[model samples]
Target: MNLSANNLCLSVDGVDHLENVTATFQPGRLHTVIGRTMAGKTTLLRVLAGLEKADSGSLTREGTDFLNIPVWRRNTAMVYQQFINYPHLNVFHNVAFPLKRAGLPRQEIQRRVRRSLASVGLADFEKRKPSQLSGGQQQRVAIARALARGTGILLLDEPLANLDYKLREQLRDEFKTLFSDQGDTIVIYTTTEPAEAMMLGDVVLVMHEGRILQTGTPQEVYERPATITVASIINDPPMNIFAGRIVGGQVTVAGFQATHVSAHLSDLPDGAYQFGLRATDVSLASTGVEGEVTFVEISGSETFVHVAVGESPFVVQVEGIHDVALGDLVKLRLRPDRLFAFDEKGTLMQTPSYGLASVEGR
Candidate 1:
């Protein structure tokens, strides 16, 4: 099933929820939509699932118009952020509900239900009611129900948001493995967390303000963000951005200078720009600007040090534990290959030869 959304536009009460959004969802691959709350992630999903009508746009499956078909008639299944299950039914019956509605034989229904349940790690909980299972287990039951529907398209809206931290992590791995082998199923997942999108999406679509900001594989988007907004949203601890200027063929931010000038900036008149670097790319140096440590966060395997260089503050991620303390002065250096330059309008200035290597080279 190839799903395509062409110039999709939706509005309510004079407010636009989706603005000319367009994308293609290829069969057998997981596509993830990532954005902040109210960024139109849910609205886009609802529109695709035929739960909401678009004011203007075209939706098609295999070149056939899909809007003429009713939501119930479409071969699509949805799992929401909330775990929805029939409290009165046991896990087996809950998963079997969709199969029964399709008029499958008793044996076929039992077989499909068992397979779906086992896929979600809920086979042993078939006899348990929703009230008797943990939140994660109940959510798995809902997933099993969707799987039992045997739909070609699966729409998941932050399905793990309701689970606890540990459970979410565990279920992420389980869901990844479960859906990896579904070559005929087209899965669309939406999430606010960048980490979740990177982990689950074979292709990721970044959205903001009802617009499709960027689309690519997770690695492509992460390594080469198209804009400053993308750089800020796609990172875990967030990229450190500083006010900068191009001076005499060199980019200068705070007290740090670029070791080499990028050809992309050769034509631009010297002016203000934004310099960005990931925390992991900033290394402690023996000879560099002195920064006062403002905060120190030590996890078991890594340490996050927040330091203030002059008036600008930046976060540094280091491996394992470090003896750095608050108020301690440390020297920091930026890896030129890992630095990003954005214009005043937040557009990324591409320098293929300046980074570690161009995308093609890698």
Candidate 2:
């Protein structure tokens, strides 16, 4: 069954939680909603699950009204950030709880429980309680329980958020295989991490301030962000944006002008524009745009230096650690082919050409 939401709006205590949101989900696909905190990801999911009613909207499942359905009868399952499993029940019984409540035959429940446990790599731990398993193992039990019932729609809200670094990585890899080949199931996952969204989602939805900003495939969204907000949200450490203008085939910022025109952007009409560049695409050079180093971050084998050039801020990512200190003057060299041009209103205009032909933004 396909699910669709249209013009959903919700507000509580004079604050808007959701605003004019519309999207359609098809079966056999995983959709990952990416946004920062309070972007209404949870609110939208609850509305779809019949947990929260939208103030003004229409929800339909294959053209039938979905809001009238009770939450328990919606045939949906949700996994929270916390590993939710019955503390007193063993792994086997915990996964069998929903099937038992639904009045499935004893033999059928056993068959499904075993299959689900094995799918999540928790078959050996069915005899253990939640407390006996480690954090990642416990989450595996929760995931198994959610999938065991054969629900039509599955919602996972950052299921690995509480796990350690190594555990998160391990589960992320596991999730890639677990969620694949979920026949006729529409899976929706919400997360704050861009990497998580891009890695797992068949289609990516970027949200902000209770609104859906952009929706596309992972490659489309990453390569062609609709707005400056999306470009920032889709990249780690966010994309660096600054005010500048292209005049007579020359690109100049408001202050500390140094870079030349981008080869792909030089043909565009002269006007004030915003440029978005990834941290990795920029570097420190002696004969380029100058700025004052405001912050330095040493992350593993890479160093990220934050610099303030005129009124624009930029983060330059370089290999290995560098001894960059605060208040240090530095020169930044930006790749001409890696810049994303935007209009004054922050809408994307033209994308850089790495290999694909640069196209005009919508």
Candidate 3:
């Protein structure tokens, strides 16, 4: 079955929650929605589950109207950012509640409950209550309960957002295996993380300010971001953008010619362009494009040095800790060959590399 949404619009208090959002979701593929907070990821999921009504839209499942169906009758299950469980019910009962409410036979409920719990690695925790379980286990119970329904559509809205780093990582790894075997199910998972979206998604939808900016496979979205907004959203610290110019086959940025682009990007007309480069592709140099260090962040083994070139911000992500201080004048070596060219209106003009970006996952 395929689920389709066309011209879905919702507004409240003069703010658009969704702006003409349209997409098709096919069964047996996991579609990940990635965006910042208040980007309408939750709203989109709620509308699909028949929990929220759209101001204007058409929702169909296999060519039949889906918006007409009540929330209770829709074959959909949703897990939220918060772990929701019956306070008084143990793990097994929490998973079996929906099955029981559906008036399934006792044997059938027991069989489904057991398998669901096992699928989420909670088979031995059946007798434990949510209060007695850790945060990760509690969320697993919520996931198991959702899986027990065997719904056609499964929506997970940042289900691991609240977990600790280690727990989140652990569960994120387990989720790939758990959901891989789901038959004919349309799974829509939303997150604010680029890594999570890339690692788990069969198709990734990038959203911003209530509109879907771009949609493609992880590699497609990363290597060939459709617009400037998409390139910024899909990167961790965001790709560094600079106003540049190509004159006589030489690319110049901040009054410095970085590379002679006649070979790689030769066909472009001489004019103003926006260039994008990943922080990882930049490095500290003794004599290169100069900038003032504005901020320095040491994250584990990597150090992110934020520098200001003129009025523009540049980030250099390097392995190992560096002796970078604020207000320090630093030189940066921008890999001009890795630059992405964009038009003045923020639309993509060209990508640097098709295969290289995929290997490095920029």
Every model's TM-score: 0.90, 0.95, 0.96
> For candidate 2, lDDT tens digit of each residue in 257-308?
4345667787789988888989988889876778999999997899999999
Output the worst ten-in-a-row residue range by lDDT, candidate 1: 353-362
TM-score of 2: 0.95
- Candidate 1 regions off by >4 Å? 262-271, 292-295, 323-329, 351-362
Candidate ranking (TM-score, best to worst): 3, 2, 1
lDDT of 1 by residue, 1-362 (tens): 68998999999999999999999998888999999889999999999889999999899998788877899888899999998999999999999998888899999999999999889887788899899999999888988999888898899999999888889888888878887767798899999888899998999999998899999999999988999999888987789988888878776777777655556556666889887888987867677768999999998799999999998899999999999999999998776556688888889975333444411100
Instruction: Tell me the lDDT of candidate 3.
Output: 0.90
Q: Report every candidate's CA lDDT.
A: 0.86, 0.88, 0.90
Work out how many backbone clashes candidate 2 has: 0
| Candidate RMSDs in order | 3.7, 3.1, 2.7
Candidate 1: residue 166 Cα off by (Å)? 2.4
Per-residue lDDT value at 13 in model 3: 90
After superposing candidate 2 on the true structure, give the runs of residues whose Cα lies further than 4 Å from its correct spot.
Answer: 254-260, 356-362
Error of 1 at 174 (Å): 1.9
